[model samples]
Target: MYISGIGIVFTRGRGIDSFEKALKEGWREPSRTGLIPAYRVGPETLTDASLSKKIRRADRFSRMAVLSAVDAYGNSGITVNEREKLGIILATAFGPHTTTFSFLDDILDYGDANVSPTKFSNSVHNAAASYVSAILESRGPTVTLTQFKLAFQNALILAGSWIAEGRCDHVLCGCADELGMVMECACKMKLNIAKDGKINPFAFSDSPVSVPGEGSVFVMLSKEKGSNNYGKVGEISFSQNITRKPDLFVIDTDGMSAYETGYKDIINYDTVIAGYSPVFGSMLTGSAFNFAAAALMLKNQIAYKCIFQDNPFGAKLCVETSAKNLNEIYCIKICRPEIKTIVRLQK
Candidate 1:
């Protein structure tokens, strides 16, 4: 399937303009949590009273998911009629944590009988996808999935199958995560963060980088290529074997030491390696943002620099060298303990 359009909202900013700008500039400014460097898509970014009049009462997760999907749909230039034929696949690791906890608080404070009904309704994992469907008025299949770190990858696999079976003309697929105080506290307790508030992906550190980030990314994909198509997504596999070397390599090195080892062992010495976690911070659903970055790089013919790390011995870092003849790109997503999913994209 071909990616017709992409929408991203992250700690850097919103839209393609902000995404590209952040890549070019690198990470000079990032929010700090205690000593850890954190990335966040400001709640104010989606809280415009005039723009979000309809979803003003919706929780942050619903607002973020709806806005990201709407942005992708608008960028795809897919009309309302066309959108009716578009299916939605939303993958999330931590869905509506803020609202979920709020409901829990209500239940504890007022008991089940007096708990807030609105919070209770929005606490489910599928609420974001439901809100997206309602806001978009999409009649096609809308599915929400959650599988820890591999949520987005699993969603992509399902979406590709749906398109192959002629289930829908197009599919809006992506992953989203919202930052919550409870999650951050858990990360701080379980993981280690850099003292300088910066993440170094290349170097080996004794302490793992525990910075938590949150955002949403949506891509409009179809079986046929369009005038605005960024690139073609072909053959998403959970199996780890690869026969051909890609022109560019995008690795999900999110400053977590555990996920970095397997990628380091697999990547070729001469292949060009690109990393973007410094700009977006580390999150379970970060691969969704990484996939968006790969599409942008293929479309623009310019590879953004890998911040905080030098180029490998035989490989060229995107910042110093140009990716001029990029035709195929490989994106590796490592979903903790043993799961590794590889996605192949071509121009």
Candidate 2:
């Protein structure tokens, strides 16, 4: 299936233009708690007037997901009536942690009987996906999955299957995650935070430089080609040995040794190797953003400069510099020594 449209929101901003500019500038915001830096999507991006009355009641995670799906649908140029044929699939490492923790706080402070019912409603992993379907009025299948680092990749596999099986004409597939105080603390305890509070993906650090980040990205995928098609969603697989290398490699290196080890062989390959984790920061669903960036680059026929890499930092693509057709892009997801999922994109 081809990617009809894309709506991405990260630390930089929304849409393709903002993401490309931020990629070139390498902008990131420091956390207030003085922990690792995080790429957070602000709450003010969606105003009260933009959302419906029912959608306004949703929690932050659902709000982000809804807005992203809205943007994806808008960009796809599909009619409102066609939405009934659209399915909503969302993937997240941590779904609405802020709301879940608040519900827990209410139960701990008061009691289960006196806890906030609204908080409890939005605490489940499927709450955000439900809100997306409700806001879009989509009667098609709505599913949510949580698989730590490989959540987004797995979601893509399911979305592709649904389209192939004639289950839905188009699927609004997305990956959304929201960071909370508890999650932030867990990151600090788990990975190494850069002392300078900056992410350098290619830097030779003695310790892992994993920064926490959160955002949402939704893409419209259809079996038929459209004018807004960015690229085609090709092969999606999960294998231990990746024998064939792709034209471009989007490695998910969050400074975690386990994730990094899975890509060691391909990391030093002669083909084009691009890492954007430093630009968007690191999160469980950060691979979603990486896939978006890679698709954008493939569509634009331009590769953004990897600021941290040693040899080629700001080299623009030319016939003399790189290949003519950047056909395949491999997005590899690794949890530890095991390779969980590999999503292949073709232009």
Candidate 3:
């Protein structure tokens, strides 16, 4: 059984109370018609040591990753044995862009003489993963991935494959992206930043731009289905360089033909979890937010809508099941200009 024990920390809310509040209020920033409500962390919420330790070394992305990882482990309710085989897979669209720009700024201003090695090291895409492994004392495999919008999905597929291949029995999968000065500059330069500085996802538009926000989310995956577990991953698949017909298009398609092809193959699923909003804020790890919501949906046996505006690549949906059947089946259809592929998921 492939299921995720989820943890999430976002601007929309923190912990369960905040999360539920945001959902209940249906908070949406009108200016950024394609983004979710932003969440912010206050100094009072963090200990001095935690705040001070990260001040000089960690970027917004890294901090989010660490906090989300901690939350995920706590929510899983399963203590990881020191000897258990574990793996980590993280995904981000703009990995450590904030820190990367800081290093560049130092070089541009000081010609490298004052460039801090520690800052440089922490700026790497895998820095968050490294810190996570060390903090958890996990010695198993750890890797990071980037695929623009598909990074989290790729991570899930990779994590699942590792389990299927007997590489690990337990794995932690995560996604994180952060807002920074550089990101703000880019948005302004591109003229994509909303005047009101928010993101809206359901608005109808041919060109959709998102506000920038920061957050991270993680999930624990296991091969064995414990009685207390939320749900199991039924199947995961991916396709690159695909081509198919255009009628299947929904809106501003961003390399989503493969996902649509996957959707057509799904037949039994009634609910879908989507991550399109996270990316609207210029955060690449949109799927991480979707993963958090998906876990909740599965556990509650609820179906929810993930709205996308003028989606040309079809909307991403996750179906939840209430029946006590072991062999639930789903079909997904992906289409490109010249190619069509179908995959099936069964559990």
Candidate 4:
């Protein structure tokens, strides 16, 4: 599948321009105003006057997904005469947990029968996908997937299959997750929280430090190449054997896993490596964010400097933002040294 456009909602800002600016600005501290240091998407960033009245009752998770998907469609600039040919696939690790908590609070504070119906409706895992499809008016197949790991990658694999099966011509493939009091409490009790407000991607430690984050990223994908292309996503594999070499490698090592030392095994001495968790914060579905950065480099023909470059392993990192010839780029997500997932992007 080829990338026609990209839309993103992150802590730094909204839309592709905001994402690129964050890349150029390099490392910035996470918000300490929350229970923990997190790259939480602000309420102001999700406000869209045009969409406010339409999605007035939608939750934050659905709002992020709707905005990102809408932006992707707008950025593609491809006039779709047939909305039925457009598909949507939304992947999330934890879908709207805060909404569920709110519904539970209503039941406890009031009564089970007296709880708000809107809160219950928005708490489901597929609510984001429903909002995306309803707002986009896409009649094609809409799927919502939830997995702790490889959620985005799995969604990509399925999207390619959907096109291959003649189910849809274009797919709005992306991911959305939100950080709230529930997620914060879970992260504190389960993972190692970074107190210093900086994620050392080079740490590569067994007990990796995590600064929890939440956002949404969507890409317009099609079987055929379009006028504007980020690159082509093909040869997606779950096996460890990687044959093709790329201009550079974007590794997703944001300290979401228990053992992140496996990431170092894939590093070659010649190829430069980059990890962008510091810019976007830590999430299980961070592969989507990393892919966004790689797509920008290929589409714009400029490599952004890597942020938070603390070279513990002495790995050759992309620390400079300059114009260069980038024919190919690979966005890799490694669950373990033995089990690896790769998405090869060709110019």
Instruction: Name the top TM-score candidate.
Output: 4
Query: After aligning candidate 1 to the native by TM-score, how far in Å is the CA of 313 from where it should be?
Result: 7.3
TM-score of each: 0.93, 0.90, 0.72, 0.98
Candidate 2: lDDT over CA atoms? 0.74
lDDT of 4 at 81: 66
Q: lDDT scores for all predictions? A: 0.78, 0.74, 0.55, 0.88
Better of 1 and 4 by lDDT: 4
Residues 234-329 of candidate 3 have per-residue lDDT tens digits of 545455222322111112122212233333322222233233343323454554564454455445444333333333434344222232222322
RMSD to native for every prediction?
2.2, 3.2, 6.4, 1.1
Candidate 2 local lDDT, 1-347, one digit each (tens):
98888887776666766777877676455555535567666667654476768686688788778777878878888664776678989999888889989998998999878999888888888988897787778988889988775778888889889988988888999999877778878888887876565665544334658677777889888878878877898888776566686777776776744445445456555566667877767777888888887888778776666656532233221122222367888777666555556778888
Q: Which ranges in model 3 have alpha carbons more than 4 Å from their true place?
A: 30-56, 82-84, 191-204, 239-282, 304-347
Q: Candidate 1 residues 1-347, lDDT tens each?
A: 99988888888667877888888888766686433457877766776554477686688788778878888887888664765567999999889989989998988898889988788888888888888787788888899998776787888888888888888778999888988888877777676765566776654333446467888999988878877788999888885666778877887777644656566545455677787888888887888888988899888887777887743433456655355777888888765445778899898
- Point to the candidate with the largest lDDT: 4
